[model samples]
Target: MKEVKKMAQKCFPLNDVDYLAEDLRLFHAGRTVGVMQVTGNDFHTVAGAGMQTIVGKGVAYLLTQIDGLGGVVYANTDNVVFNHDVADALFNRYDAIIIRYDKETNACALKLIKGTPSSEPTKYIPKRSETEYELVIKYVYIVAGVGTITNSDIKDAILNEELCGIAVDTLAKIPTKQYDDQMKSWISNSQADFKKWFDDIKNQLTEDAAGNLQNQINSLNNKVNDLKDIFVVMEEDSYIPPEERKIGRLYFNTTDRVESGFNNEIRVSPNMGLKKV
Candidate 1:
């Protein structure tokens, strides 16, 4: 007994095991390509003429759970133009948008393969082959008489896997604001949420033993007011009022008038009287 192994950096299958193709594509494109092309919703279909199903931009190695071997191939380079016209008055049927990979040539391309006509939509069989690996990206249900196919008629097959996903950021998904008639911008939806950041900073400063900025400014003003007690000033001639003469107090006394201006004497009170320096 031997264990089956797939090659590293590539997928491989051993001969004598009629499961060659299936084994090779088991992890083809690594189960999910993760929505490679962002443009036009990644291979989405648009409602159009009954005979024509428009597939939007598609570029990825696509697959589905049921497409064991044929579920691994590169899809169309761009939007697909393919006809899935009514063969007759169809009761109902499913059509697959597949990426066909020809192993012999190692070339991959897109194709719209008609599924087995089914009265029950769930019973429709999509394309699957060994040589030409047909990876079904989507299952499109053809409405009666081939009416316009909308998004509802198409079954997105990517989400079949746990990591299978599609993400095309649309303006509708975003919260935006129009700046003016000719301009637009994104803005905060609520003022409280926007102002919470500044409020948090102010609150943190109070808890950290560092007073808030407003408190600091008020403290500074108090300290400036206390400076009045440090020194008292007298601006006059040498005659100073007896009560005004105090130690460390300074006086600017006029000496004489000069060409520039009146000269002043600098005197400091040493005792109860002012002494000229």
Candidate 2:
């Protein structure tokens, strides 16, 4: 008896439009591996053929533009028994999937696809064969879309309560406008207050400096007056005569004192007393 070997499955490349459609389908289904951009009219012609053509016999393609979220390319495969499971899974996962045609280029791409999880998981059964059970497998395709998603789109989605699973009424609950105005007013007032405080400190410093300089000048004037007092001279009446002064002696002549002999008498006397003039 001879032993047999199982054959390996082969992979093939999809057309540009089909690839674009597959990318859209995965994006809408939230199973995307990455994103791509489709340019030119060729994208439109095939997308116009509808989901039947987009999905093709065993696989389908879709494309869309996204901004800000970043770009990637991705795909997946799972073995299953029923075909309806794939459709059910896709429908359950996605909230909405939009397909639009660009008239200018006569091309169509997946514009947007939003997704949510299904309430229940898909059930599968094993196939029985003569020798054992066999598991069937299915392939899911994904590709890139045309254009890019922008930050503005994300902002709009957040504001509109379209993204993040937030309710529209919840966003309306906050007073955004009032809060913004209050914040601006508070900032302006704070800046004004800081300026006033800084000016006050500066003025005080200037005044103190002037006061210190004046004090130094007054102290200097008082020192000068004290110095003058130390060097002051006494009144003239208080001065001692030079002849009577002990420091230096003086001599005086008396010629008319002798009464008897006026013509021949003359005397020299020493005057030791200080005299006042």
Candidate 3:
């Protein structure tokens, strides 16, 4: 009998790179970001409602993991790495961090003319150079600005009111109400359970990290407080007074004189959506 030889075959299931890309797309889809459109008899506004949620959650997750990272400066083109280390830190330190996506350009060949300057606008393609990207994080101030609401004030508002009327109305169209309720309940119960269970476990362990965990919890609580302050400012700017039927827009004067410790250069346009509502 002749010996038989078998040919080697390449096993090509999904590789790690492809797997990561798929996961990233899925994660992006899950957030309240990306493009949105509204159409119906009511002239529904389909603005990206999840934009805030996605940014908030993403920043929160990143913040917990970032230790000593500084403002990230990365390339804008092909090998773009969207690191959220600074975002995370800002999320923990400030009420809101505004992130804007900007377009980039490539360098062009220069031509010189005698006497008269070149009349043509610089040539710019939709393309960016290999390493051209910009990411900025603008921190939202609580209490010390146009509105007097402090971080503590926002938390007070939450506890005082039956519910945050503005947040509820904003999330009215969300299909994840059931999930949200479930998560809220779980968080409430888990916090209590962990306090007891973890205390017992910590006592038994040779080295207890309870102090460190508490510090982290405190830091997270501070972030929540900061957000509360921002909420009050937002409410003041946009929330319609009960006596007034029309929802008011939030207006900020960017060019106005700056108060100490506050930025005056970046003004907020009163939300046009309020009038439409």
- Highest TM-score against the true fold, candidate: 1
Error of 1 at 155 (Å): 2.4
lDDT of candidate 2 over 40-131, digit per residue (tens) = 11111112111211211111222223321111222212211111112342333322222233323545333333333345423222222222
What TM-score does each of the candidates earn?
Answer: 0.40, 0.21, 0.15
Q: How many residue pairs clash in all the candidates, one count each? A: 0, 36, 4
How many residue pairs in model 1 have overlapping backbones?
0
Comparison by TM-score, 1 against 3, better one:
1
Tell me which residue pairs clash in candidate 3. Answer: 32-50, 76-132, 76-133, 250-270
Judged by lDDT relative to the true structure, which candidate is superior, 1 or 2? 1
TM-score-best of 2 and 3: 2
Sort by TM-score, best first.
1, 2, 3
**Whose lDDT is greatest here?**
1
- lDDT by residue for model 1 (13-54), tens: 545654344455564433343355546567777656656777
Q: After superposition, which runs of candidate 3 have C-alpha atoms over 4 Å from their true positions?
A: 1-17, 20-23, 33-96, 99-277
